[model samples]
Target: MIPIDLQILKYIFMEKPIYYFKMKPYFQTSEYHDLCMYITNRSDTQNSDRLDKRDYTVFDLETTGFLPEIGHEILSIGAVRMNGNSEKLDEMHQLIKPIRPVPNHILSLTNLSRDALNQAPSFLEGFQRFLTFSENSTLVAHPAHFDVRFLRAMVKRWKLPEYSPPCIDSQQMAKYALPDVSHRLDPLLHYFNIHSLERHHALNDANMTADLFSELLLIMKKEHNITTYSVLQQLLNRQKS
Candidate 1:
């Protein structure tokens, strides 16, 4: 056998053991330090933390355009954490400098100016901060596919290692919970009688989505008796199929 020191050196040089996830973000807070890794194995269905007791990161993005593929880019990110509506946790909002100027319609919608973005972080850094804020929580969004698509697009654009997490789409859940009405955020908020919340702003949008998610969780629990993320994932998977 090789000598112990040499063996260790060989492993270190060639095939280092994975003590922490390689793709983990450059972390921000102590709360997120140990939890920066991507979600690899999902939780158990029956024995894990029930859906109402767990944490979720609801996020939104403002972009220069709709499609990330055709030179569209993210301009801002906003996120908030929720735990069964027990308490409102800290939220994260970041502006990212983009390659393109903000469009007139987009500027009118988001109220963000090019001047503001001049002082903001790069896309990679902003995304890293958002991920750090997310910690190990499940992700949620109004229409999750849009936000997730942006994220995946950024990962590819920046040449960063991949990072995709389990996400709950509040819009789709609203469709399931109240099938008769449109699943758009503003309409759902109106249907649920959630009032006074602003729209278009990223942070406001994220919080609004979280509120909708909380309402839907109650409906899901009562109607389907669903109580865990695993079960929710299974249900969502079936819907996709």
Candidate 2:
């Protein structure tokens, strides 16, 4: 056998053992400190940036049924992205195949059936396309709570991350902007003289919603000079509160 020191040297050279040690509390604490610093910096950056009015992707969905649970699913989604100037940027209309069969009542209501959606894409696929088409813009919908709830459930079902962007509800906005008149879409559309070529269809409803939003904005600007996103957000928050 070799000398002890020599044997030790041979073992060190041959094995090159990696000694694992628990990180000390101080070192582990610094990781949290670093994360906090990162978050602070990010928040500061976000706060320092100037806010601008953004385009909105107005959308509507026709579903197999009213309830999100109990196997109700979206049959079609229609969307149109409108710029700050109220010009349409991109549009999408897609049919979705529901996991459950379309009931006869629903089929009659939406004119969508199992056979009609046989070749259509799934909700996950269609929603992904809508996200891409929307392109970081805000979402607009009439009676938004209803549509948002359905969309949120669908997004959760597909394991999609939460949507962080803002959403504008023309219904509530109209309540604030035109309190004197009925807030229903049809009546509001008629009030603004917005023609609805087709009713109940997702695309046509989305188009009508987009038009109504534009008209409402114009009326707000002309009457109240409300033209900023921050102001709109504040007003919406106040209404909610």
Among these predictions, the greatest lDDT belongs to 1
Weakest 10 consecutive residues of candidate 2 by summed lDDT: 42-51
Candidate 1: worst 10 consecutive residues by lDDT?
Answer: 15-24
TM-score for each predicted model, relative to the true structure: 0.79, 0.76
What overall lDDT, based on C-alpha atoms, would model 1 receive against the true structure? 0.74
Each model's RMSD to truth, in Å?
12.4, 18.8
- Clashing residue pairs in candidate 1 (N, C-alpha, C atoms within 3 angstroms): none
Taking the tens digit of each residue's C-alpha lDDT, what string does model 2 give over 56-145? 889999986665633357899999888767898878899987765577877787777678798897665676577667755778899888
Give the winner by TM-score: 1
Clashing pairs in 2: none
List the candidate 1 regions with Cα displacement exceeding 4 Å.
1-49
RMSD of 2: 18.8
lDDT of each: 0.74, 0.72
